[model samples]
Target: MIRVALVGNAGIGSQDHQNSMYRPAFERHPRFELVDTAEEAEVLSIAVPLAERGTAVADAIRAGKHVLADKPLAATLAEATEIERLAAAHGVVVVPAHHQRFGAALRSAIAAVRAGRVGLPWNVQCDFVVAGGDPAPTGELVNFGLYPVDVLRALLGLEVHRVHATGTPDLVTLLLDHEHGVTSTVVCGRVPALRDVPPGGLAVHRYRISGSHGVLAVDARKPALQVRTTDTFGPVWTGPGTVDVLLDVLAAGIAAGRAALGPHDAVQAQRVIEAAQRSMAVGQPVAIGQPVETGE
Candidate 1:
């Protein structure tokens, strides 16, 4: 069994509570064993807030443990870069927990795209908006907007050339130009998920990819089934299943001594978000992949 240590407790892990998706997923998987401490584990899974993620991963890597951290690996691009640097020095792998990509709807959409159902995708639009989440230093762009940024990058396999963003902490829009001549528009908002729908309500997550042949659209909140518990009524298609897939990926990455999804993805997302913030602040488009001035 692959011995693992789970850190954090509120959102993803139950630090103060006894319930966590990671703990139960590991317990149910035959190939995984949950250890009480990072020192005793072969791998570390971090579900802490972004502020604590860098230090926790660094500590685990210094102790010779692989790390699988929740998204937005660090609050800043420099911090994410430093984390990657530390992992390399320690010869440990670090991967982001971008499990949403493995959702059934997204998976099916990706499959269709790869199967030539959407040929030569040129324009892509995505919206990832949900309500009632804590605010961060970087606002919605980093907190939730990174999802669409990562998705566009993963699907197009292109580098971001430019980014333009406008909006408030609760809502933001981004226009991106990629290296491969593809342009993408992403909209992310923070509105109450449980609020009553207005005239034309928007789904929590939506994607539209237009290609040479056809268009691919997905409504992530469209429940295949629903469950009505005593306390709540919610969709049956929430994230645990994808988290299971992520657990397996982490396990395989640990066994192979390399990360299946390395820090590059997280780094790119951070870079784009940083650029978007800059764009929002300056009221202009920001070119990505530019060399940072050392000011020596």
Candidate 2:
């Protein structure tokens, strides 16, 4: 069996570990075994606090285990870089848990875009808003906000060249310049009024891609997709149930002897996030893929 260990007890891991460990989906999988500690596993999943992710992932790598970390990679670019370097040196795979990457709704939307159903996507709009909760932690972006940013990059197959951002404790807006001249605007926030939607209720993370042909909208909240044409607009059906697809991807990567997110890709994403932070700090657009002067 492919031994796997979960490193965090929060959010999905708390529920997933309990449910999947007991359910046939994971328990009966002929190629897997979920262990309680990294010490007994060939692969580790780090789903802890943002600050601890890098250290935990690095430790697992040092111990010769493949690692799958939840998104945003690490709290800062530096830590992410270190983890990447160490993982590479040790020849361990480090895959970020970008579960949305494997979503059928999202995959379908991207496929439609690529098939020219939406033409050449020029502008993109995404909203990841949810009700209730305190402002995100100081100096940190919201958990789900990163979803759109990363998704835009993946769908477009481009890197963010520039970023302009503004926000308050509870809300954030980001304007991104993509490689192909595509512009993306992402608005994310947690409003107290939305709290009534239920815990994990209607956490609306959706995107609208506008191209020369039409518009394609995908909503993760209801797990649906909408395509707008010149004469008609309608919803497209997708698979049922919320699958932890990333975990399966992680498992497959480990079994195949590969890292989910290579060092370079992880670093690049972190750099984009860091640029957004800098843009917010200086109240100006920040150019990505460039060196910034540091006092230290």
Please list the Cα RMSD from the true structure of every candidate, rounded to 1 decimal place.
4.3, 6.2
Error of 2 at 257 (Å): 2.8
Q: If scored against the real structure, what TM-score would every candidate get?
A: 0.85, 0.80
Question: In model 2, where do residues sit more than 4 Å from their true spots?
Answer: 10-31, 133-135, 139-142, 193-196, 224-243, 259-265, 291-296
For candidate 1, lDDT tens digit of each residue in 157-268? Answer: 7879899999886789999998768899988876755533321134468789899999988876654467767776555565447668777777777778776677777888
Least well predicted 10-residue stretch by lDDT in candidate 2:
13-22
- Report the lDDT tens digits of candidate 2 across residue range 1-296: 77877777443222333243223334555567788877898877666776677777778888998876666677777777787778768877787755555567777777788788888999989887766543445432536556667678767777889998898646788899998799999887776644235433335678899999899888755454666778655445455433345556666767666744354566676777778888988999999866333221
* Residue-level error in angstroms, candidate 1, position 147: 1.4
lDDT of each: 0.74, 0.68
